[model samples]
Target chain A: MRQSRLVQASLFVFLAAMLTGCGSHVPLEDLTISLILGVDLDEKNNLVISESSPVFNQDAKQNIESYQLKAETVRDSRKYFDALATGEVTAAKIQVLLIGKRVLEHEDWFPVLDTVYRNPTFSLNTRVVVVDGPVSDVMFYVPPDKPQMPLHLKEVIDKNIDRTRAVISTLQVLHRQMYESGMTPSLSVIKKEKDVEFTGVVLLDKKGKYVDTIDAQNSAFLLILRDEKKQELTLTIPMTSLGEGGGIFHKNQISFDVSRVKTDVKTSYNKGKFDFKYQIAMTVNVAERLFPAGRVNQKELEKMIEKELKNRLEDMVKKFQANKIDPIGLGIHARAYQYEQYKKVKPHWDEAFAESNIDVSVDVRIKSMGAVN
Target chain B: MKMAKPTLTLPQYIFLIHGVQMGVGVLTLPRETAEAAGTDGWIGIVLSWVLATAASLIIIQVMKNYPKGTILDLLRHYFGKWIGIAGTILFSLYFGIMATVIFIREALFIQAWILPRTEVYILIALLSIPSYLIVRKNITILGRYSVLVFFMTVWMMIFFIIPLKQAQWLHLLPLLKEGWQPILDSVGTALFSFGGFEIAFFLYPFLQKKEKASMGIVIANTLTLFIYLIITIGAFVFFSPDEITIYNEPSIVMLKILEFRFIERLEIVFFAFYLFVISVTVLPLMYMTVYCTSQLAGEENHRRHLIWLLIIAFVYVVLVPPTFDQNKLLQRLIEQAGMVLAFAFPLCIWAYLLILRNIKRRGN
Candidate 1:
């Protein structure tokens, strides 16, 4: 009995020493989890980091507390946020990362988000958005009639992504885009004029510098070309100006909801450049037909829609080439199919892609016409 | 002096081998093969399955000669008593160092992901408790624990579905673009992950059906390969070619992208539960070490040796807490030693035994 007691005493002492090794565990309410992180450059090119965290305590008057400070990097700004916050600031639940347009103008501002990738606590699925004027405008904006900005921004982006109205540039996807030699990064731009509005996806160059903007109408085509069509991709295109309906309203636009889309890109190399043929097959149902009854036969109407859709897709591709950006990931196809030739111009694929031959042909099969007479 | 070891059923025996083969190596294997080879590293995994399966069969063949004796007794019979003692010590050292390697790796994983502030010695001590308690029991308990742990942790593979949903598939394109040389080079790295099958030296006599040892090991290697290939291909398609080598543990890090409405920070929950899976490796290796030491010292199977081994583990963790880079170096060196012991040693013994039997037959 004495020996066993002595052994138990020694074990207790050893465990006591180990108790000092680990840190204290704070409850979740004590942690000021940053829901939104914003990065932008000021007038003097100094980096500005902003954070907005939800106030969990009922005593706090406001639901959210926000702060902005000038810091060298995202990691260094945590101290500033902690100083102002009542609790320890953590970036574990950050939902949106808003990058200012001016910051994207610089060559190497993508590194400003180094901590998001380095810190394991930060989620990789957080959506990334580029704010067109100042990220501060969007970051600090609070709507009089909405949920928290962080939740609202995430909801909007997710909804738009499902509708194929915008592109999703989550941290994980952005990492792949930034490093992939074949394709460039594309993130939807948001601006706060009076309210937060999603201006289309901003195309960035190979170095993550701003290149061009693809509007909401065109981003759908971009998504389709990339074979990233989501649950609902509805398009309303003006087929012709043949006749105005018997009123002041002109009825020439036809709306359709795409049910399925299959895209195939065939790559070939010739004299000095590569040739890419985009064969797009879309199965769509006519949602709304704003035209006079029996103006044209169904076959003729199908032909008109195919020609118009083909023209629109071709125009979209031309716009991509004009900006020297391959946001649709044509370079990915080029790499997959033509490795030997793609390797030579991998570094400068944007320019080489600009000089390539792209052919687009669409085959739209009407699956159904809506219940309208 | 002792009763016979409770015989291990085929499934328990199979789980024992499979669980040990998939240790810390599975976490970083994607990055290892990617750096050595390209996205075509899946080929290396298949090649390794064949090589490891064949090597394990050679061990079964060598032990089949003396069906009743464990590997230590077989050594003492084939060679002199002094040589057998030396062989037993070397085996003990190898298995003991392997246990230490697994302990340090599990600590490193926990520290980097879950408990960055906790001292590694505490983590090592904590791990040693379970190992000590488990290793003191007989192989029957250990075998049962291994099979239970396998079922408990196998559901974690379903978490892999999220990454595959967003897979590029283009990343794995242009297969063999760098040629077969890189894949062949990566086979060396993949072979080390398949190292635990070498424990068959001690497990053969404990198995119920001695003839099924070959078939059991073959099935175990296939299970290990299936898990490795799923992770290897999943990571290959999920991460771009250039991005895979940046993180040390891309397999675990890739799980960070998983966002379920019900749970946040699933990887934390994952690593915590993963300790059980990792124990499947640690407990068995620790047992192998303690059993080897007691057999070599001509002592009874008692708790004293296990206690000494745990104390030694604590001191090693405190004095020379291996950082990630040191972990890599130690892992490489240990794996090379394993290759020699598991492969070359068995082949040489088989050759020597073959020549001896031929001469004896001629004389007869």
Candidate 2:
């Protein structure tokens, strides 16, 4: 028995050794790691697939190289790129996918992304951004200050998302909004004017077509309305409604850093209309003041800030209603809180939401007036 | 019979059954149940747990009549040689198909996620090596290995909470959106995931505390139910009702959303470690199939048959390339066969034993 055990051990080692040398093995150094992939539509309506990979070859001066190909699908571009590169194009490291404005304008951007969802090699955690222009611009554009464009772009989006300046739209989250009836898909939008800048977020309708873009200033408000506030959000409001100051200083602008924000959406169906009251409660610390600190009345200042915020949020809601979109997921609240009523409008929830009576009320509390006060 | 020893402790039985029941099915439990029952998938899990527990208890009852022998001996002792041979062949075939299905599924997952470049045949071969080594051992080690694996991998469930941060709890509302018909249809799919408990037909006779065997299986079923319920609910809340269907493996997709400061694509690491958990399912089933096959071959010891069974399984996996459609067909086949063998067969045997006991008492 002991002799037989020796033979078995040797045979096992032999097999392990032989198995390691089998087919379909790609070494790490031999792989071209794609950090970002871009999808766009060509002039002839063909699919344009672009990929940015960090150049690791010591001889190369550039840190990143991008390759673009016009193909029928994303998977087909890999074969074409393989011929141009020295290594196998591996997409498991894909950090971001940028969709061009032209593609987003098309009716079904979801079908173009079928490979990202269906292909096992694709990373579902890949952050998806909607480019305001052609995705090739963002994919190929390299900033002088940034070390690597792909890594820099990912960090930019990640930082904004953490600070609630941009919406968090991973491929998984995008898939959820695309599939959820009560919610429409939205992605962080980026524009390449001089440097890569986060322009805010682009809203997609139920069919995954772009509806409108929210600027960076209101994106925070949009996030607040969605109850997705992750970190401290500071908003500078122009308080024109507040009375003019008599001194040399003009207290026309007041900026406060929001320490705490709580938004509660109450949905009630009555008389064939869905009524939603969004109560936004915020506590803030005075960050900057155009007027002198001694003249500031904390109670009066809080009221002015509250009134301006409420009006702005009301306007934002009206914009959403006018655009016939629910990026804030009001339909989600309607579905959860009032399921019976929501069922009737499930087929055309955006239209129902557009006609719904939505009210916004902001209650701002000045937690601290800063050190001077 | 030299190695015939009743070494399986009560807790070991629970872990063994639990380990078996938790396999590739857990990975896709949400998508499967959601497809059938929509947001009400958790209901199907609860129903399947109850049914699996009942079926397991009946198998335990069947074993109570003959406390000293495996199901093979019981069949032979009750039905005489020829009929017993038929039953043994049938049981062995059931286990063989099950092990093959698990083998194919595991290799396919490995190829899909971790080693996209690795050939399925190579994965099957590499997977069988571990099964051969483990199945060659006694049941006590298998049980202990299972317990260790359970503890080691159970903490991975903590990752589910990461995605729960993004969860919209509202998705789970409007309970029974499609009504009872979908939930009931989903019960079949959920029951298929609970197929591993049928191993109790063989393990019951070897349980150290025979009376606690029923409760042990019940506890195992309940634990499986709880795990499935949490994962299914997590997926339901994490993905929208319509969105959850698009994911073939919702649990893995849920893991993909989690990004750590140091780690990127966490699902790759999770899938690598998950291989250990998947092994507990494949290893014991491999042992059972070999044991049953050797029993039918009139061998007192099943160790020699282990290598041959592994080869056949490897060849089978290589022969059947698991495309999406082919894998679906195989899963459906196994689910139907498991329902018959795991749920229905034991009840038939229990009834047969009842009638036999009544006739013998009346004759006396």
Candidate 3:
């Protein structure tokens, strides 16, 4: 037994020495982990793919390196990126994917993203950003005095999403929306200016074609209607109906932070159409009252805000019906309660939603008026 | 041959059965259930749990007639030596194939997710070490290892709650939208997941509290049902009803949505730790095959048989690493075999026992 222990110890040491291994591991610094990938159509309407990677070697002149090549597909472009980089380009760590608006204008463009989903190594949390201009512009946009563009773009979207200024669109969410017939997909939209700007969100039709865009202001109402409000939802409304004093400074607007919102979609079929009534109860802390406190009483101010918010919401729903895009996923509620009617129209849910009756009612609860009255 | 005393407590019996039932089925259970029944497959899971629990109670009832002997002894006494040998060969074949399928599937997952470049035979060899080391021990240590492994890995369920933040509860709505046909069909698939409950047949004789064994299997089946329900519902809510059917392993793929400030690929770590829980399923079934074979051979020792079994299993996996279509066919075959052995065989023996009693009473 003692001699067997000697043999066991030696065998253990030998096996650990040889086989306690990485199959074929690459050191982190040696591999090119592309942080951002972009796809666009050039002037000739050819598919152009690009990627940006952070350079780790100190000898490189710049902190980031990028490549742009016209390629037919995302998988086809990898070889080009591999050929250009010092190390093999790996996409498992991609943070942001930017699609040019030219690409979104075409139907069946979702296949461009098939590579990410088909490959298990690619992350599902990578943010899918829609570039309002050219993908190349945003891919090349490097502002001075900022961190890497990928990190900057990710933080900008995360910060904006927290404030309810933009929608959150990861690749996983996009896959669900693209396949879900009950509702069309929407993604966060960004534009290339002096710096990268998160403009708002773009709405896609069932076939994954761009229909229309929602600006930052409309996006807030859209999110509230969709029941996707984030931590801080501040809306600046012009109180024209209340006839507040147009002072020399012209402070005729009220800005309030929506602390809580409750939206219930009561669905029923009426007149051969689906009818949805949205009962919205918004709790807000009066952050800025542009009108003088003495001018209006608290109850009257609450009534004014409620009336204004109701009109805005109704108008937003009207736009949704006109565009025939149910980004708010009201069809989800319809299917939940009114299944029989919803299934028949499921193939063309947005059109059925367009013909439906949507009623918007707002019940405003004032949580607090800032430190003053 | 030296044997330890019959010393498995009620909790140990429950964990052993529960842990073994949770095998590689979880990796693809949601998609399998969804393939047949859509999101309403949760109902099928509950139905299978019922069937599995009934079958488990029947096993306990059969064993209660002969307290000191295992199922092998009961078989030989009731039907004589020839039938006893036949039953042994059948049980061994069933358990052996189930363990082999589980072994290959575990290796497939490790190769696909964690180490793609490593040859599968090497991974199979690496996995075999745990089975050999643990199965070589007595039943008491098996029970202890299960209870220990359960506590060590149960906290991993908390990671699932993060994805619930984006969960769309409506995906589960319109339940039974297509009617009852699909839900009933997927019960076969769910029964395969509930297959390893028959390990209780071997464990019944060792249980310290014999009466508590019935309640233990009931609780074990309930725990398995609870796990299946949470994982299925999580997958259902995370993916759209239509989208859930697209991925082969939505349960594992669903983990890709988890991200943190410090970690990006959290599923890699989750899969690494999950190997412990998966082993609780593989090891006990491996030990049961060896034990059942020895009981037939009239040997009190099974450790030597275990070594040969592992060697055969490793060679089989290395020789026939199944492709995608081949894997599906293999799983279907095993599902049918398990349904017969775990569900159908129990009631048959119980009825046989009743008939034997009736005949003896008439003669008297």
Candidate 4:
């Protein structure tokens, strides 16, 4: 009993010593919780950093305030940010990273993102988005209706991602794509218009340079072709065969809400050129019909929609080929399915993709008419 | 001439061996194996299991002759007193060095991922305190602690479900694309992760159910095999072949990618919880070192012997600062030495004992 007492006493001493030694360590109360960070290039080509942190003081009027500085590296920018702030700046709670279009125009954006992945303190699950203009405009632009800018941006991206309007582009996935030679990196694009708006997705070439932007309407088509659609996506297509009678609201337009999309891609090499065939089968519900009820036959409408969808998908692929970008990861499929053939053209896959022939076909079935005949 | 030693049951035997074998090495097993063999690292895991099981059987065969004594007694009987003393000294040094490697490796892991600002020596000091507490106890308590550690860590395997959904199965295709040489080389690397099974050498004499001893060790090896196979293959499918080679610890990297609604930076929490699992590895080896040292000194009490070894571990880290590269080099060197001690040394001893038994019986 005496020995046990001695052991307990000694253990208590050790615990006490450890706790007192850590007294000088930084606690949670003294940290500036960074919710959103932005990176952009200024007029003189210097690196610009901006951060928005929540104002927790009871007397403060606004919920969040923004800070900006010009520095060489990400780690270097923190010093300047700390001087103007009440507490030390930390990235542990960062939810979104906004990159400006000017910074991405250069081919050296990967190094700027290196600190986020390399620094042990930063979280890799932070969502990365590209801004169509200067990132500061979006970072400081807080709408009166939204709770906070960071939370608002995160919810917008998350909601649209589930609805198949934007791709899932977290920092982890971006790092993987940047390292992979088979697929190029792409990010959801947000623009600061009258208010905050998710314009579409921006595609980067193999060199990490911005290539082109696809609008929300075409973003859904692009996601389906890439096999990344998740939830309900509604697409409105213009029926060209019907006469153009209406001016603003076209009477020839029809809308379909796609519930399920399955895309299969096959690649083959014939002679010297590559050939890809995309077989897309979609089960959709008719959300709206503008054509006259007398001219609408179930089978005929399905055929017309299928042909129009096929043409839209073909046009999207043509745009990708014209830009010499493989955002949909077709090269990944080629490498997986045809290892031997893909090896020969692996060095310049973009040029090879530009010269290839891609076939797009859509098979649509209207499952429900939504309580309307 | 003797002290009263405790005996362990069949389940304790299984948990003891399992807990020891699956430790700090698992955090980097996928990266090490992938660097050796491209996509066929799983084959290396199977081969290492086969080799480890065969070695365990040999150790068991040698122990079956001596009912109440350990390898120290067997060595004294087969060889002379001086050689037995030398052998005991060598094994003690082996355990000491292994304990240092595991302690430093885990401390480095904690520094790299969890607490970046803390000094390595401070981490070492803090980790060693709990280790001293556990190693000071008797073998029965250690066995119970091992069983507890096993149950606490088994639930972490469920976290892999989130990352498995994004895995690309095509990365594992075209088996043997590089041939068997790389697979064979990786088996050499993987033998180190299975190193702790040699603790059976000390545990055999203390097993209560002698009839089921070998069965327990085999089950333990098979369990470690599946654990390693799941983690290694999970990393293989999740990362591209070229991308996996860049990471030092692929398993933690996989956990870093996991996101929860309320929790951020889950790998930090995992490493914190994994401190228990890492302690199980060092505690048993430290106790074994103290046991071997006490036998060498002809003293039955282990408390003084354990303190001296812990002091040496504490001083060793402060004296020779180990960089990440040096720590990696030490791990590889230890793996090679461990292969010889755990695999080759036992087969030779078992063969010699068999010949001795045959010669004596033939004369009779």
lDDT tens digits by residue: candidate 3, A1-373: 9997996798577557547356467888888999999989998999999999999998988989989998889999999988899888999999999889999899999988888998888999999999999998988877888898999999999998999978879999999999988888999999987878889999988888999998998889988988889889999898777674466755778889999999888889978999899999989998887777887787888899999989998998898899998889888888888888988999899889899999999999888999987
Q: In angstroms, give how far residue A150 of model 2 lies from its true place.
A: 1.6
True contacts kept of each: 0.69, 0.76, 0.71, 0.31
**Which one is best on TM-score?**
1
**Candidate number that wins on TM-score, 1 or 2:** 1
Off by over 4 Å in 2: A1-17, A21-29, A42-46, A244-250, A292-296, B4-6, B351-364
All models, DockQ values? Answer: 0.65, 0.61, 0.69, 0.44
Best by lDDT: 1
Q: In model 1 chain B, which range of ten residues has the least summed lDDT?
A: B296-305
**Model 4 Cα shift for residue B134 (angstroms):** 1.5
Compare candidates 1 and 2 on lDDT and give the better one: 1
Expressed as tens digits, the lDDT of each residue in A46-143 for candidate 4 is 99999999977778787787998898987888998899877789988889999999998999678887789777778877899999998999888879
lDDT of 1 by residue, B1-364 (tens): 6776678999999999998999989999999999888798889989999999988999999999888877788999989798889888998999888888888889988888888888888888777777878889888888999999999999999887677988889888898878999999999898999999988898999999998999999999999999999899999989888788887788898788877889978989988988888899988888889888998777777477888988998898889877988888888898899999988988998888889899999999
In the order shown, the chain A TM-scores of the predictions are: 0.95, 0.93, 0.94, 0.94
Give residue A173's lDDT in candidate 3 (0 to 100): 91
Can you write out model 4's per-residue Cα lDDT over B21-64, one digit (the tens) per residue? 98888988999899999778889989999999999988898889
Docking class of 2: medium
